[model samples]
Target: MRALHIITGLGVGGAEQQLRLLLRHLPADCDVVTLTNPGAVADGLAADGVRVVHLGMGGNRDLAALPRLVRVIRAGGYDLVHTHLYRACVYGRLAARVAGVRAVVATEHSLGDSQMEGRRLTAGVRALYLASERLGSATVAVSEAVAERLKRWGVPAPRIEVVPNGIELDRFRFDRERRTRTRRRLGLPEGAFVVGGVGRLARGKRFDVLVHALARLPEDHWLLLVGGGPEEHVLRRTAHEAGVAGRVLFTGERPCAPDGSPGPDLPSLTSAMDLLASPSAEEAFGLAAVEALASGLPVLYTSCPAIEDLPAAAATDARRVRGGPEAYARAIAEVRAAGPGPRTAPPAAHHYSITRSTARLMDVYAAALAGSSPSLAPLGASPS
Candidate 1:
C-alpha cells in the first residue's frame, strides 16, 4: 500500500528514530513529511532512499502548513496516512481526511500522565488531542501504559492499539570487540563501571538523578548520558556540583544506531556500558531500558512498562528501584557487587523485535482499511 508518515520533526529523538527504523522495515511504498526541522534523521531517511519533505511550519499555530500538507497528501494519492508525535497527529489527520484518505493512523509515542512530549497537559491540549484523535482511524500506543493513559483521557479502548516500540535485535546484540573499541574511544578507564542514561536531556527524564546517584558511587563508577537538550547545561552543573563532572560524559544526541554517521552509534555506546539506569518515574515504554536488556546489560529503572508487562522470568537482570539518589546508589552498588552476567539478550528483547512490530503494524493498517478497530489482547497478555 502507498502510505505517508507525518511527524513533528525528523530529529534524533526516540520517536523520530523509530519512524526512520519502521520505514526501513515496512513493506508499503512510503514517504515522510516533517512539520518543522528536518535534522539528522531527515538526512538518514534520504540516505535510505526514503522521500522526506520538510513542511517548514513556523510553529504550532502555523495555519499555512495545513493547506501545504493537504496538497502534498493529495498529490501523493496515498492509500493511508500515519502520523507520529503531537502536532503532526492533530494536523496530519485533518489534512489526510481533507486530502481524501480514508485510513489514518497515529502513533502516540509519548503520552505520560502529566505531560505529553514535555508539554504540560493543559485543558486546551486535551481538548485538541481528543478532538483531532477522532480524525484518525486508529491510535497506536507505544506501550500498554500509554494505551491506558489514552483510555483515561477519554479515547475509546477499541480505537487504541498497543503496538510497542521495537528494536533491531541483531544491532543491539553484545559484541566484545565493539565494547573494547567504544570504551577506548570514549576515554573510559579500563576498569571503570559505566552507568548509562539515554533519552532527551529533559527535566522529566530526571537525568539529574543519575548525576547525583553517580556522586554516591565510587570514583570509578562513571555516568554516560547519551542525548542532548535544555537539561544538558543543568545536568552538567549538577554533575559538577556533585563533584563528578569529570566522571560524567555527555555525547550530544547520537543516532538510534549507526546510520553511517561520523560519531559512534547507540549500539556502540551500549557496548561500552556496564549498566543502564533510568531514574525517570514516568515512562511510556522505557525504550532505553529495553535496548540495554537487548545488549544484555542489567537495568535499574523506576518505571518501564516494557519490562513490567513481560514475565519476570523473561527479564531477570532488570530491577526496579524506588525513591531518589540513595535508592539508585544502593541498587548500583548491589548490581556491581553481583558482577556482570553473560552478554546475551533475553526473551523480552526478542518479543519486541522490529520485524514483529512491522507485522503487527501491518495488521493495524489492514484493520483500518477494513473500517474496523483492531482488537486488543488482555492488558498483561503478550501480543501474538
Candidate 2:
C-alpha cells in the first residue's frame, strides 16, 4: 500500500524517532512530509532511500501550507495518510480529507494531563484537537495512559487505539565489549557509577532534577545527559551550580544510531550506564525507559505509562519515584545498593517489538480502508 506520513517536524524526539523505527518495519511504499523544520532525521530518512518533503511552514499559524499539503496528498496517490504529533495530526487529517483520501490515521505521542506541545492545557487547545480528531479514521495512542487521556479529551473510546511504541530489542541488548568501548570513547570514568538520562534537554524532561540528584549521590556517581536542545545552557548552569559540572557529560543531539540506523546511537552508550532515570513530570510513553529496560538497566521514572504496562518480570528493574532530586537520589542509591540485576532483554520486550507494532498498524490501516467508522462526531463538538 502507498502511505504518506506527516509530522510537525523531523527533529530528534520520541515521536520522530519512533516514526523512523516504524518505517523500517512497515512494508509499504511510503513517503514523509515535515510541516516545519526538516531536521537531522530528514538526512537519516534520505540515507534509507525514503522520500522526505519539507513544507516551509513559517509558524504554527501558517495556514497557507494547507493547499500545498492537500496537493502533496493527491499527487502521491497514497492509499492512507498517517499523522504524528499535534500540528501534523490537525492539518494532515484535514488535508487528507480535502484531497479525497479516505483513510487517515494519527498517533498521539505526547499528550498528558500536564502539557501539550510544551504548553499547559487550555480550553482552546482541546477544542482544536476535538475538531481535528473527527477527520481522522483512527487515532493511535502510544500507551494506555495516552489512550485514557484522549478519551478525557472527548475523543470517543472506539476511535482511540492503544498501540504501544516499539523498540529494536537486538540493538539494545547489553554487551560487555560494547560497554568497554563506548565508555572509553565517550571518556566516561572507569568503574564510576553512571546515571544516564536520555531525551531532549528540555525543562519538561526535568534533567535539572537529575543534575541535582547526582549532587546528592556519592562522588563516584556521574551524570550522562544524552540528546540536546535549547535548554543546554540552562542545564549546564544547573550542573555547575549544583557542583556536578565536572561529573556531568553532555552529548549533543544524536539523531541517528552510530551504525546509521533510524534510531539514536544509544545502544552502545547504554552499556556504559549503571542506571537510567526518566524524571519527567509527565510521560505518555517512555521509549527511552523501555530501551534501557531492554538493555537490562535498572530504571527510575516519575511517570512512564509504557513501563507501567509491562509485566512484573519485564518491569522488575523499573521503579516509579516521586518527582524530586531527593527522591531520585534515594531511588538511585537504593538501586545501586541492590547492584545491577540481570542484563538481558526482558520477556515484555517482545510485546513492544517494532515488528508487532508494525503488524498492528497495518491492521488499523486495513480497518480504515474497509470504511469502518469507529465513531462519528460533528467537528468542534465537545464530549457529552
Candidate 3:
C-alpha cells in the first residue's frame, strides 16, 4: 500500500502515458516523481521496476519545488500520495500535506471545455485548481467527461471519481500477422487506405484536422502521424500546405509500450492502421480513440469522452466526426465506402480494461486510505 506518484513532466504525453500505464497495473508498492522533464515516461518508469524521482521543478512558480517536494514526501515512507499532471496536481497536493502523507490522491488528467492541460483556463487557473483540490483525498476522473469537467471545476460530487482510462487488453488485440508486419514495416502500400492519426502532434491535437483531411483523400490515402510534439514542424507545415506532403507519415514518438524503442510500437502503429482519425477537438480520455478501438481500428473522432460515455452499441467501430476538414472529408469518405469491418475489440474495448482500471484504482486506494488515514495498510483487493 505504499504508493507515491507525482507527475508533471515525464514527456510522451497522454497524462504521461497514463502514468506509465498506471504504474504497471498497480497493486501497491508504487513510486514515481518527475515534476520536471524526466523524459520518455521517465525512461519507461525506470524500465518498469518503478522508483523514479527527479523533482527539479523550476517552472510553475517553483517555490523552490515546495521544500524539495517536502523532502521527497518525507523520505518516502509514503502510504499513499498519487498525483498526475497540472503541475503535479499543484505540487502533489501541497507535497502530500507537507509530507505527513494522509493518503492523498489526484488524477484529473486534462480537464477540458476551455482546457486545463492545453492551458487556457484562467482566474488563476481556477483558483489554483480549486485550491489544490482541497488537499486531496480523492479526485480521479478520467472519463464521465472528466467527471462532468470536475463538477464544473468546483470539484465535489463527493470528490469526483470516474477512473476510466485503461487498455492493455492483450496490448490492443488485433494482429493479423500484425497487419502484415506493420504494413511492410511502415512503407505501407499493398492496398493502402490507412488514415490513422494517434496523438500529441499537438496544436490541440487537431493534427491540422488530419492534414486537411489528407487533402480530401483518394490517392491510395495514407496519413499515419503517431505521437510527437511541438506540432512536429507544425505538422510538417501542415503536410506541406495540405498538398498531402507525400501522403504524410511522421511516426516520431511511439511507445505505448514495446520499448527497445526507435519508433513503431503503439501496438505496431495500431497494426498498420486503416482508420483511426482523431481530429482532436478536445479530449480528456479518447486515448487514441480507445487504442483505435483496441486496434480494431475504424474510429473517426471529434472528441471522445471515451466514446461519448459509452452506450451506442459500445463503440460500433466508433464514429463521431463533427466538423473541420470537411467533416473529416465526409467521414473519411464514408469509411472508405464501407469496406472493412471485423478486426475485433468492440464492447468499447472490453469497457476500458487494464484489469478493470486496476480494480477501480484499488477502490480509489481503499477509499483514500479509509478517508485519509484510518491507520493505513488496507488497499488490498486490486488486481482483477
Candidate 4:
C-alpha cells in the first residue's frame, strides 16, 4: 500500500511529532509520501528514507500550491492520503479528491470551538474545513474532546473516529542518571525545585501564564522554557516586566538530530525536570505531558477539556489551573507542596507506541479503500 501524509508544516509540535511517529512505524512495504517543506521534522523523515515531496507552502492558505499537491498525489499513485492539522486536512483532502485517490483520511488535532481569535479568518478556515471533512473518506480525532467538538461543527458521526495519541515507552523511559546530569549541566542549584515546559512560545500555548506562575512561586524554584516561536521576544519582555526574568531559563530552540537520528540531548532535557508545566489554553492532546509522565515526571496544566480526557492516573499528577496570574500561581504552589508521587510505571507500550497507532491507522486506510463505511469507535476505545 502507498500512503501520502500531509501536514501544515514540519514545525516541532505535537501534530508534527505524531506524524513522525506514525511514518516511522508504518508497514515496511507500504510506500510513504510526505508533503511539507524543510523544517524540524523534515530532516528526520528524510533520514528514515520516507519519500517527501515539498509543496513549498508559504503559509496556511497557499491555494497556489494546490495544483502542485494534486500533481504529486496523482503521480505518486497513492492508495491513501492521510493529513494532519487543519491546514493540511483542508487542502490535502481536497487535492486528494481532485486527484481521484481512493482513500483520504484526516486527523482533527484541535477543538474547533476553542479557536476564538480573528473572526474573519476563522470563518474562512471553518468553511474550508467543513467542506473538506464532508469530502474526506475518514476523519480521526486524537481525543474524545476533539471528536465531540468536530461533531458539533457538523461532521457526521459515522465519518469520525477517536484515536488517542500514543508514545514510545522505550524512548521515554525514566533515566535517573540523565536527569541528574541535565540539572547539573544547566547550573541549577542543588535541591532547587525545577518546573519545565516545552512548546511553541505562542498565544495559544500561553507561556506567559507560566512566567507569572513562576513569579509567584518561592525563590527556591526555577522554570525551564524550551522551544521557540514568534512570541519569544514578547514573552521574554513579559517575564522581565513580572520581575521573574532571572528565574526563567529560556533555551531557545534545541536542535534535534538531523535525518531521523535521535537527539542526544532530548532524554536529559525531559528527565531532568521535577515536573512538566503545560499552560496552553488549548491542545488536541498533551503529547509533552505524556512524555513527561512516561519519564515519571508529573504535569501541571490549565483545565482544558482536551487535557481532562487523559486517564485519571495521568490526570492525577496534573492539577488544572485557571487563566489568571493569581490562579496559576496558587495552582503551582499547591502542586509543589504536594510533590508528585513515586514515578508511575510507564503505560503499556501499545497505548502510545507509534507501531500501534500506525496499525490502527492502516485499518482505516483499508476500510476506506474497500468502499466500506469506516468503523469509528467511541473515544478511548482500544484498536480492534
Candidate 5:
C-alpha cells in the first residue's frame, strides 16, 4: 500500500517526530510519502529510505503550494493520505480529494479550543477546520481530550478516532551507563539532580513557570531546557529575574535521531535527568513526558487535560500544579523529594511503540480504503 503523510514544516515537534517514527516503522511493502521541505526530520526519514516529496511550503496557509501538493499526490498514486497539524489537515484533505485518492485521514494533534491571535481569526480557523473534517475519510486524535474537544466543536463523532501517541520503547529504555556518560559530557556534576523540560519556548509551554520553580529549588538542582522558539529570550530574562539564570541550560533544538544510533545524545539527555517537567498549559499528548517515563524518569506537569489522560502509572509520577510560579515551585520540591520510582512499563507495547502505533495506523488506512465509516470508541479502545 502507498501511504502519503502530509505535515506543515518538518521542524522538531511531537507531531512531526511521530510522523517520522511512523514512516520509519511502516511495513517494507508499504510505500510512504512525506510532503515537507528538508528540515530536521526529513534527513531522518530519507535515511530510512522513505520517499519524501518537498513542496517547499513556506508556512501554514500556503495557498500557492496547493497545486504542487495536489499534483504530487496524483503522480504518486497514493492509496491513502494522512495529514498532521492544522495546515496539512486542511490542505492535504482538500488536495487528496482533488487528486482522486481513495482515502484521506487526519490526526488532530492539538485541542480545538485554543485561542489563536484574535477571537475572529480563531473562529475563522475553527470553521475551516470543521469544514475540513467532512472531507476526511477518518479523523484521528492523539488523545481523548483532543477528540472530545473536536466533538464539542461540531465534528461528527463517527469521524473521530482516539489513538494515544506511541514511542519506541527500545530507544527510550533505562540505561545507567548512558546516563552517566551523558551527564559527564554535559558538564553536570554527578551528584547534581537534573530536571529536564523539552518543548518550544512559547507561551503555551509556560517555561517561565519552570524558571521560577527552579529558582525556588535547592542550589544543587539544575534545569535543562531543550527546544527553541521566539520566547527563548523572554524565558531567559525570566530566569535571570528569578535569579536562577546560572542554574538553567538552554540547548536550542538538537538534531533529532538522524541515524537512529540509539540517539545517544537525545536519549542520554533525557536519561541523565532525574525527572521531566512539563509546565505547558496545553498539550495534545505529552510525548516528552512518556519518553521520560520510558527512560525511568518521573514527570511533573501542569493539570492539563492532555497530561491527565496518561496511564495511571505514568500519571502517578506526575504532579499537577497550577499555573502560578509558587504552585509550580511546591510541586517541584515534592517531586524532587519523591525521587523517581522504578520505571513502570507503560501499557502494551502497541499502545506507545512506533512499530505498534504504525500498524494500528495501517488498520485505519485499511478501513478508510474499504470505505468503512469512522467510529469513535471510548478513550482507550483498541484500534483493531
Candidate 6:
C-alpha cells in the first residue's frame, strides 16, 4: 500500500530516528513529509531512496498550510497517511481527512501527563490534540505506559494501540573493535569509566541531572552527551558549574543509521560507553537504553516504560534507579562494583527487534484500511 509518513521536524530525535528505522523494514511504498526543519533525518531518508517533502510550516499557528497538505496527500494518491509526533499528528490527520484518504494512523512517540517535547502540558494543547485525533483511524502508542496515558487523556481505550519501539539488534551487538575505534575517535582515554546518555539535550530529558550525578562520581568517571538542542549551552554551563566540565564530552548531534553502517553509528557509541543513563522522567519507550542493553552495557534509568515492562531475563542489565543525583551515583557505583555480566543478547531482545515491530505496524496499517473504527485491540505483549 502507498503510505505517507508525516512528522513535526526531521531532526535527530527518538521519534524521527524511529521513523527512519521503521521505513527500512516496512515493505509498502512510503514517503515522508516534514512540517519544518527537514534536518539530518531527511538526508538519511533521501539516501535510502525515500522521498522527503518539506512543508515549511511557519509555526504552530500555521493553519493556512492545511489546504496545501491536503492537496499533496490527494495528489500523491496515498492509500494511508501515518503521522508521527504532535504537530504532524494534528495537521496530517486533518489533511488526510480533507484529502479523503482511506486510512490515517499516528504514533504517539512521546507524551506524558506533565509534558510533551519539553513543553509544559496544558489544557489547550490537549484539546487541540484530541480534536485532531478524532480525524485519524488509529493512534499507536510506543509503550503500554503511553497507551494508558492516552486513555487518561480522554481517548477511548479502543482507539489506542500499543506498539513498543524496536531496535536492530545486530547493529547494537557488542563489538570490541568498534569499541576501540569509536573511543579513539571520541578521544576517550582507554581506561576511563564512561557514562553516556543519548537523546536531544532538552529540558524534559533531564540531562542536567546526569551532569550533577557525574559530578558526584569518582575522578575517573566521565560523561558523554549525544544529540544537540537549544539546551546545549545551558547543559554545558551546568557541567561547568558542577565542576565536571573537563570530564564531560558532547558529541553534538549524531545521525542514526537504520543498519548502523553510516554516520556516527549509535551502536559504536554505545560500545564506547561503560554505562548508559536515562535520567529523563518523561521517556516514552527509552530506545537508547534498549540499544545500550543490546550492546551489553548496564543501564541506569529513572524512567523507561518498555524496560520496566520487559521480562526480568530480558531486562537483567537495566536498573530503574530513584530520581536524584545521589541515587544515580549510588546505582552507578553499585553497577561498577558488580562489573558486567557475561556479554550476550538479552532474552527479551527478539520481542523488540525491528522485524517484529515492523510486522505489528503492518498489522495496524491493515486494520486501519479494513475500516475498523471505534474499537481497536492493542498489539505487542504486556511486559512480562
lDDT of 4 by residue, 1-384 (tens): 887888877756656766667766768343334455557677666777776667777776557877788878777878888887777887887778778777788887766355722123366767777977776888998877778878887788988887777776777777788778878888888887888888777777888878887888899878888888789999889999989888888877774632343332455677777888888766767777777767777677774443476466544566666667678777767767886567654452225666677778778777778874332211121112
The residue-by-residue lDDT of candidate 2 on 36-137, one tens digit each, is 989888888888889999998888798888888988888899989999988999899888878878689999999989788686788988898899999988
Q: For candidate 1, lDDT tens digit of each residue in 1-384? A: 999999999877888888888888899999999999999889888988999999999999988898899889888989899999999999998888777686999999999999998899999999999998987899999999999999999999999999998888888899999999999999999899999998889988899888888889998999999999988999999988899999999998866445463213878899999999999989989989989999999999999999999999999999999989999999999999998899999999999998999999999999888884332211121112
For candidate 4, the lDDT comes to 0.71
**Candidate 2, pairs of clashing residues:** none
Deviation (Å) of 186 in candidate 2:
2.0
TM-score of each: 0.95, 0.95, 0.33, 0.87, 0.88, 0.93
**What TM-score number comes out for model 4?**
0.87
lDDT of 5: 0.73
Stretches off by above 4 angstroms in model 2 are: 372-384
- The segments of candidate 5 whose C-alpha lies over 4 angstroms from its true place after superposition are 28-37, 58-62, 115-121, 258-264, 303-307, 310-314, 343-350, 372-384
Tens digit of per-residue lDDT, candidate 6, span 131-212: 8888888899999989989999999898788888988898888888988998898888768889998888888789888899
Clashes (backbone N, CA, C under 3 Å), per candidate, total 0, 0, 1, 3, 2, 0
| Number of clashing residue pairs, candidate 5 | 2
Quote the positional error of residue 272 for candidate 6 in Å.
Answer: 0.7
C-alpha lDDT score of every prediction, in listed order: 0.90, 0.87, 0.81, 0.71, 0.73, 0.85
Question: What is the alpha-carbon lDDT for the whole of candidate 6?
Answer: 0.85
User: Where does candidate 6 stray beyond 4 Å?
Assistant: 256-264, 372-384
Instruction: Point to the candidate with the largest lDDT.
Output: 1
Query: Which ranking of candidates, highest lDDT first?
Result: 1, 2, 6, 3, 5, 4
